[model samples]
Target: MTQSRRYWIPSVAFCAVLVTGGLAAWAETVYVQAKTAQLRSGKTSLDAVVGNVKYGDALDVIGRDGSWVEVKTAAGAKGWIFSNKTSSTKPSGTNDTLARLGHSMRGGDASATTASAGARGLDKASEGYADRTGVSARDRDAVDRMTAYQIADQEVEEFLREGGLGEYAK
Candidate 1:
């Protein structure tokens, strides 16, 4: 090959490498829905709640896996979010609240866990009221909250159930 042609070929190859590498570094911003959302440092609430999130806001995509995405919001905030709850869904306020509840159930908040445990105990006491032919209203409320909290943890629960945790095990 001619000397000039050989130099041109290598230059083109170098440009291709640069373009591909740059694209790899390009971070994508995704929008959060207008609902309760939990952002955690890791896949579960056991990972600290990294940030409080709301709907219709953008967070930068840092990484992803099935059903989860690692995101960084403006101000350099970072966290993991359920992938399904983000972008192009109709009015998913319920899921958002569920996600937040998962955090509580997983001991994401120290104060919330204590309060929730107390509520659970109170709820069990209300079962005694059933003997009197009326539900203990307070206990019923506590049970309802507990049930909802478990449901909120369902995603992380399912992930663990399906051996997703194996990926993180060291």
Candidate 2:
């Protein structure tokens, strides 16, 4: 009975170690967050490019060196990528409001024109009414002159220095 108990204890201990090691070996998963991420052969940007990953591509993190992470792709390619280029979650689509608006306009969304006009503080109905009522050329000329006005660089610098703005702050 003593011999049996000793063997059982060692077997249980070995099994626990195996399980713990296995869990540790399971690589952490991350996704490429940049529009284009280059996986390099070394931790530094000067290293040879080993692979290219687009936004949302999955990578299994194997290790890290400073700001770089070693990873393996689903295709079994292994390389290093900047830690900043990868995220634990997949990247969402473009965050640019202008890009989204452009897409909406290109897609022919019925409300896009109205939304764009509203953004400029103008309504389509009011614009059409004004057009029908004849907008003053004087007002248009004033706007054009205002847009064409430019300040000399030296004068702008002087204004900034006087106002203690940004790098000009005392």
Question: Which candidate gets the maximum TM-score versus the true structure?
Answer: 2
CA RMSD, predictions in order: 13.2, 11.8
Where in model 2 is the C-alpha error above 4 Å? 1-26, 94-170
lDDT of 2 by residue, 1-170 (tens): 99999899999999999999998687589998876777889987557889888888999998987788999999999999888778998766666778788877778443323354433333455445556888776764464456457787657646856887532344
Model 1 Cα lDDT, one tens digit per residue, 1-170: 59999899999999999999988567587778635577887885457777877777778888897767899877778889877657843345555988888976887333332344454443333444543667666766666677556545547656754774522332
> Residue 110: error of model 1 in Å?
45
lDDT of 2 at 62: 88
For all predicted structures, in order, the TM-scores are 0.39, 0.47
Q: TM-score of model 1 relative to the true fold? A: 0.39
lDDT of 2 at 39: 86
Pick out the ten consecutive residues of candidate 2 with the lowest summed lDDT.
Answer: 110-119
| Backbone collision tally, model 1 | 3
